[model samples]
Target: MTTTGLLGAALLAGLNVLPVQAAAAPSLPRDGGPAAEVLARQEVLDRLADEITRVPEHERSLVAGYAGHTVDPRHGHLDLYWHGRLPDHVTKVLAAAPTGVTAAVHEASYTLRELRAGRDRLVGAVVRGEAGAVWTSAGPLVDGSALAVGYTPDGGGRHGVATAGEVSARAAAVAGVPVTAVTAAASTAASTRHSDASPWSAGAELTTPGNGWCTSGFGGWRGTTAVLLTASHCGTSGTYRTGAGAVVGTATDSDTGLDTTVIDVNGTPSGKYFDGGWDNGSGYAKRVVGAGRNNVGDLVCASGAMSGIHCSLRITATDVAAEVNGQWRTDLDTATRTDDSTVAVAKGDSGGPVVASVNGGADMQARGIISAGTGNPVVCGSVAAPTTCWDSLRFVPIAPIVSKFGLSLA
Candidate 1:
């Protein structure tokens, strides 16, 4: 297992308690171009959420089914909602007995009326778990008790992790799981220096030997050092190392249940592929920047061991949850996407980075890490398709995760 998987697996093996929430991923188009497109995607995703809130539960599930394409599939193996999906699917992701686990939707992008009004809510409904209960002009605020960190990012301006009490009741109510208690989660402003990153994309032939078949996530700055990013579960548990298996540094502070970890690799097999995530959906394939706000039409992918379903997961936003290890966690939509893509992530995939490829480059951007969702090989657009696959997947964001531990990439 990678260091992160080893740690989480070991922690659960020991029976110690910790919060968990992982699964995530996507977005849209534009001017300055990548940035504008990201914002536009966010708007589209926001509209979808608005519509999703109005749909009834069953219908929400149906929409969730297709939209869930973005949330499922994790080469890293840390799907915060893995055990929290509709009881039946839960068994598929969770072990016979899981450790810290929780996941539920805290916000809806749309309302039923909105759907009827203009299908505008489709963007939000595509990613939301349930249709919204009530509505207000500025979208409603979620209840505190119902969230991991009490977050609500369904509308426009998506924030990082919500504070301990910032979640609104409406938001919490929409979440599928209980909202009694919550472990620390992402709270940092996801809008950091990464807003203007280059799309570090890659091709089939550019595989580097020592890098391992890993993915990427948001690059951040700890103090002054610029460190590459990925799920804590991606690296060796104890510290950072190189393809040679040599100890380099330690993971800053990983949140197991959250399925997020940062290797300080202050000096590991150091290269230079930017320091953070590059999660962007479709078009242009921009840099993997920003968190808590992903949208439709995004083209994201993860890399890890060749064993599992390691492939490109198009973003969808239905039946989503934002918790870690099963605990309510952050605001990023716990993603699910169609799994028919050729990408196959395996065991070693845990903690592997998921990069958003834009114009294409020598490498990929570090977006989110491999995490599980609810469906098996997510089935999108059409569940009845003879080849419909599962969609239980998750990829935890790096910023919120790091904030929870109060650690730095430095």
Candidate 2:
């Protein structure tokens, strides 16, 4: 696939297209025909994206089930993907694609929608304890045709047959989907980030009005009002207080179905995002210039009271679904170690800042916040002093949260 095709797939899979300034075409002469051509193509691509959003939910699902699409900005053509030869009806739909946007179809495996559905089924099974001893999450391959189920062996050195088998069966039941089991370690459960918290600042520890502990996300403002963002699971309403025992805000709105909320704070929340959380003596201060969208392969670092700043974690997947508080949550992004190292996201890190480094870490763009993980404890240290750790971390992208609440980052 061409670069444009790759970008199209990334957007389809819930990734943000890089800003125009980040694209390589900028190196080309602006007055040259190539530059003008690229800009025009970008405009058309933007229209196509808007059209996609306008598609009704029912029709959108059918389109997803039928195939995926990518636009070759250079050629101004849209390429559709499918497991086999493009079906007749799908081809017709492509032929009628938005004017100025040419269309073609390429054969692939299962559609992205199918893969997401399969993942949901498998996760739901585990949440209901139908998956037994397997407590990790699963996802679809890049082509969106197959599922990868993750698990760790039980204390008996065995991944129970019934549990693993059930997960596979559920995924396989999804038409044209296959399951691949992976022996991955599980992460630890959510825990408070710090025993000592600071004034209401991004990445500082705070207790939900209900007394549930969590880290605050990036602060925002609406004219004279100050707003605080945090994980929805933290609590919907109550007086949120700083670790220093000062009341900072009131939880006014929360969407428990999703992992985000907004608090009405009395004072202006700081625009500074803790680079290395208070725990990391190496951490410094960085101002959040703007909010950023996430994509697979992006290098992101997160800050929390427990873990401070852990960087070099590569985002592996978007559109992740997991069971949270007896409900299945979807549209989550995941980060994993790019190399074998001790860096991991842990409890009390929830609702903390996840940012993409810029200028080699001197500045940063706020990305998202820690939500949940595999819930499997990563054991480190010698046999005599085993220490529990976190494996992988999942976060809800901040773009959606900001859009949902109609707020701007401070």
Candidate number with greatest lDDT:
2
Off by over 4 Å in 1: 1-220, 226-228, 232-237, 268-292, 305-312, 322-344, 357-366, 377-392, 402-410
Error of 2 at 319 (Å): 0.8
Q: Over the full model, what C-alpha lDDT does candidate 2 score relative to the true structure?
A: 0.59
TM agreement with the true structure for every prediction: 0.38, 0.66
- Looking at candidate 2, what is the lDDT of residue 55? 42
Stretch of 10 with least lDDT, candidate 2: 25-34
For residues 185-233, write the lDDT of model 1, one tens digit per residue.
Answer: 2222110011222222211111112343333334455665454454443
Query: Which structure among the candidates has the greatest TM-score?
Result: 2
Writing each residue's lDDT as its tens digit, candidate 2 over 1-410 gives 32223224433333223333322332221111123344344345434533543342122325644434444544555454565444455444443454445544455567767777777777666656652435365666544447776665461243454356664655466423788766554433344333323334577777776675678888887556788888877777788876656777888887765588788887786687665434533324577778655544455677765555666566676666655544556667778754344445656667888886433344567888788755345652211112234657888777667766888888
* Segments of candidate 2 deviating more than 4 angstroms: 1-107, 121-136, 151-166, 174-176, 183-189, 192-200, 210-212, 222-224, 280-283, 339-341, 379-388
Candidate 2 at residue 218, lDDT?
Answer: 86
